[model samples]
Target: MIRRMIRLYGTWSAEYGLIRTHVLIFCSILEKSHKSLIGLTHRVSMDPSARIYSRFNLHLYDIVVLVVSNAWAWRCSTTSTLLPFFHKNLGESAHLDVGVGTGYYPAKSVHPFSKTGNVTLVDLNEATLSTATSRLRHAGYKGTIDEVQHNVFQPLPESLRGRFDSVSLFYLLHCLPGRMEDKGPKVLANLADALRPDGVLYGATILGRGPGVSHNWFGRRLMGLYNKKGIFGNADDTLDELKRALEGCFEEVEVKLVGVVALFEARRPKMK
Candidate 1:
């Protein structure tokens, strides 16, 4: 028993890394969260990547991912690129958002008129789904706010078919498992089931490779860390493959790479 205990601690200390080892130990001992640590170990073995977005992690998302990671690590500026694209495609009527994270884009969007509208938030993570739903409601969106805890890899609910004026899939594709060729088309086609005939689908994803994709030292470090942690599965993702995936799902596909990120808009779902 003593030897087994030593082995476990050795692995845990190494796997948790320096900073997280300290923080998690403090959290665990202070709260007596031995069960939580065990559960966390189980979660990692299960590769439930979405579980990484705990309530605590959600609190740090905007500042850590949006502001700091976007500018310094990814070389993409939230102000000049991502924010403008999000606002340009702001859905005022019957919107659907998949893989929502802290409801950043919707919370930051500006509506030309009216303070309320319908929005369906879909995510595999309960914390993210609840956080996004609450954020939209708090942002004065008094209309229908529905939450669907569903995976994009699976088929969308039949009732949700062709029900939205616009669907946004921002920062979602890269985090999904499988190659871009395999996952991208399937997910896009499934979401196409949610969009009206003329409705547009727009969002951005961090591309892993291609001619123009730039990964500086900081970006590389972040990419390595995220991929290693299973928080990202986009190491083999490329912009050209994404374009083809979009084309297969939509009639009009527009894609551009900005500092290793591909901002895309697809209109008129081909399968719709």
Candidate 2:
């Protein structure tokens, strides 16, 4: 898979002028052998004190991990395609993006809301927040942007509660500290509190239980190793548990499993 990814990026480098350098750098890094990459990932994942995102510098994260592995190679189908489709519903609605890493989704998704509405980006990492804010501005987003260097594991400020028309938690929950059974419900409830009446909650997450790894031997092995190392907190975060968590907070909920990722569109009911 690593060889294939290297070859794939090499092909992309030859074709695209803009990202050619970044792609070549990605290929060079991967050439160091897949095992080394996995070992590095394992070390990062296992460190409870050092979150993976906070541990890596901006260049390694933005250029290599975010650009090459996530955007170019496409790890999560929900983030790559489905989430963007749902995000189009944000037409002129105030949106809050929790864990807005590198502003990938906001940059890729058309933000009709930016002209009339505002955007609040929240993340634990200051560098990530700055990078995302800068990336969005560079991508031509002319909206009132607010950056909050706050951890999602804690409650949001009272001023932000029940303020947004939409709240996005793209690829956030699994990366958080603690068990998903306890953390997942709490996170959803906190985000739900930030939504205005009839507001929409939409995003994607990596699921530990899914068809992608079940059928592939190598994929299953990799996931097992990741889960054991605390890289993924979703080992027990099954489809049923996720549905129940959403249903507990929102009046309406829809969830679909795309490969090893879960795509969801949930809504808070309007108050009487």
Candidate 3:
């Protein structure tokens, strides 16, 4: 549908162009609504055993869609694609997901690791965490999971200090800006400090490619407004930009391009 709309707009103009723009905006909203409805429907349609331990039930299809959508956005591990890095990085084989929205990554991707390990889920949204807590239990995940209402912009708690073997930034970096060029570095520096010497930080985010596809001058101005309010920044940042920023604290960095999204794995320096 999204592609169809783009194609329809390509052949039209003037009045039709104006109408198409509105249609595109409306469709974007509808797309989000549809995904949420699908997610809810999937949860309710699950078999009894599937919902046994969790409050909300999720069917296999829901996880599949979430994983694929994230992969499109350049933030996931699609089966037969990326190896299970979480299993390789953690000492206790522990994983930490920062800004974990509704536990989507863990619910959809972490199951592969759960057979032999545990994950620590952290997010600032209490409601989201509540939902995650229920879902993890429902899945009967064997790993020791921790759900915390902690803000990533601030220093993490001492109890969690130097604790994670691998941490996932997911798509959260693009969500914060205004001083992204500064704040991004500071945030990663803090994350680097929190990781054990041999630990790894895995992340994916959109990169900057000017303002193509987005509206226009007014659209750019609107984005600037969003930047001021800290709602969004560069939806995507270049690999070199992110690497140069991360190099200050991390010893080694590896990056891969997955469409418009950039995936990164940076390791903390070993102790002398």
Candidate 4:
């Protein structure tokens, strides 16, 4: 349906990216509404965060999220801060990326993915899976790309155990359900199971507030709305708890705050 719409209207529109973004966002809302009518409870439908990316177009994400939100709202410079952080830690061997957003890192990274390695993308949202896969391929990632439709809350299957040399959790923690103290560690433990003992787990997450967090007016406004809409569950999240969570599962943990986002790395998953 989306492909057909893109072909029908995209071919004719000068603002093709804008049109696709609007269409996809609207379609996702419609899809959510249709599901609610079918069987999803009212409570389930309220938090559209989980199913929100089902129709997201990568270009739209780049413009709005990477450009606008990261600058005016989050105040984190993607090119200088985020991209460098990602490049510094990205795995050259078997890699796992959880909560893969439109596959932006791979699509825009200066650090190339290993053509001889494997990249396993894990996400509950199929739209993200598809989009990320497309982005990786577009970026000339010659390695094997694997998509696993799975929740971060659950343990990865045995086949995935100790498989990856690196795992990324970019912008994933805050969007998860429940408070960060509970959700954060549980999710970390689940991912730890997927990594080899020497593997590194690194990624960034937007924090609600903490010692290092500073939210400007725009950031505050967006945070409030996102939390209220159930798009974010990090209203009460703190950096201390996140550090504690990472330290619990990994022998080495490092966390730095850039704007309202926390960039983190944990190595040597203490496998149980």
Residue pairs of candidate 1 with colliding backbone atoms = none
lDDT of 2 at 264: 84
Clashes per prediction?
0, 0, 8, 0
lDDT of 4 by residue, 5-96 (tens): 98878667857677557645744554455455335334433335665554533446677668877887788888889888877777667888
Clashing pairs in 2: none
lDDT values for all models: 0.80, 0.65, 0.58, 0.79
Candidate 3: tens digits of C-alpha lDDT, residues 25-85: 6435434544564556464542211212132323332443345333433344454333344
Report the lDDT tens digits of candidate 1 across residue range 120-190: 88988888989987887777765777899888888999989988878888899989878999999999999
RMSD of each: 9.7, 8.2, 9.6, 10.5
Worst 10 residues of 1 by lDDT: 26-35
| TM-score of every candidate | 0.82, 0.72, 0.64, 0.81
lDDT of 2 by residue, 111-147 (tens): 5555536788887766678887888788888877899
The list of candidate 4 runs beyond 4 A from truth reads 1-47, 56-59
Candidate 3 deviation (Cα RMSD): 9.6
Q: Rank the candidates by TM-score, best first.
A: 1, 4, 2, 3
